[model samples]
Target: MSPRKVSLMSRILVYVLVAIAALYLLLCVALFVFQRALIYFPQPSAYATPDNVLTLPVADANLQVSVRPHDGPKALLYFGGNAEDVSQNLPSFSAAFPDQAIYLLHYRGFGGSSGSPSEEAIARDALDLFDRVYAEHPQVAVVGRSLGTGVAIRLASQRPAARLILVTPYNSLLELGIRQYPMFPVKWLLKDTFDSAKYAAHISVPTLLIAAEHDEVIPRSSTVRLYGQFIQGVASMKVIAGVGHNSISESPEYLKLIGAGL
Candidate 1:
């Protein structure tokens, strides 16, 4: 080929490479800016009434808690999945633990709670909720499911929880994000990396880590890794057979296992 033709080919190749690089950078920026949107899918409460709901006043937001009030020392505080309306769990929790009080948190921006949801914001809210609940109910069990598992574990580590229960839990949201988006720089882009494993080592209370046999959202390997983080004899794990991540609670053994843990 002539030198002029070779030079033309080189120029075309450079243009293509530059365009690819520019597109990749734009994609990364988009991921970084809107990452929280991918993480939290806020849902409206199904059962929000004056009789059952309790308003928790925080620094910036007034959080809503779905409560089944029982005049006793035993209470259960629940943090639910990202998209879950925690109020939905009230009936089942009330039925299962008739003697114990139940309080399911509506994360900020979820279930009529004000302000936006973020890892730091939710963590603060969880701690506040625990403190208030503990004032009345000395024997309080902290229960978290899916995304809330991260919140529960952190709270259990810092507070004097009587019992801790995690359902469909993961080692860390950072690891999960990388697994789902391998091509992206999730570590750098993710704003709210719920690193449950970091807090797991600090937990001293009797804990139960529940895994769904066929959980599609959280890998079994992730759950096993998290289980290993807890001090030996401090935590125990149970796998509910023939159930997916969302459907595990529907199983007969679900409530039985939770009640047994408490």
Candidate 2:
């Protein structure tokens, strides 16, 4: 090859490399800047009636907790998914477990709650709610779905929740994020690790993990891995057939299984 052709080729190669490097840096910066937005999908509460709304001060934020107050020892505390409007499920929950009082938390920045949402903030809020509810209701069962599973697991491990139920659980947000963004350094970029697997090992109460047979959002393997982390005989997994991650709740047997677990 001529010397001029070799020089041109070298310059083109350098330009290509630089362009790729610049794109990568831009991606990293975007991930860092909007990480929280990627993790949390906050929305207003679906149920605004005075009968259902209860406010609790969580740190600096006044968290709105949806309550179905019943005078009894048995209570159910629920933490919902990222984009979920937990208040929408009130009717189903009330019908499913009419005997037990139910409390569903709207995470920070979600459902009209103040401040931003993070794994640490959500976990702290969950523990605070658990402690407060436990004071009144001795037999409190904790239920969590998707992102809330992390909060629930951590709370159950640290507190004395009578029964624990996880729906469409994952091993960890870090692991799932890594799988979703294999090309990037997800482990380093992800701020909300939500390592439920780490907390699962410490949970002492009877735990039931509800897994979707064809979960697309959270892989079935991830839920199974989380179930394995629990101490022997402490946790059991039940898979619902013909459902995906979000659709698991639509199944007729969804609430039935939860009632049975509790």
Predicted model with the maximum lDDT: 1
Question: What is the TM-score of each predicted model, taking all chains together?
Answer: 0.98, 0.97
Off by over 4 Å in 2: none
Whole-model Cα lDDT of every candidate shown, in order: 0.96, 0.91
lDDT of 1: 0.96
Per-prediction count of colliding residue pairs? 0, 0
Tens-place lDDT per residue, model 2, 1-262, is: 9999999999999999999999999999899789889888987888878899889996679999998999989999999999999998898999999988899999988888898888888888898899889999999999999988988998998999999999999999999999988999988888899999889889989999999898999988888889889999999999999999889999998999999999
Model 2 vs. true fold: TM = 0.97
Q: Give the TM-score of candidate 1.
A: 0.98
Q: Supply candidate 1's per-residue lDDT for 32.
A: 95
Worst 10 residues of 2 by lDDT: 39-48
Residue 43, model 1: Cα distance from true site in angstroms: 0.4
**C-alpha RMSD values across all candidates:** 0.8, 1.0
Question: Candidate 1, residues 44-125: lDDT per residue as tens digits?
Answer: 9999999999999999999999999999899999999988999999999999999899999999999999999999999999
Residue 165 error for model 1, in Å? 0.2
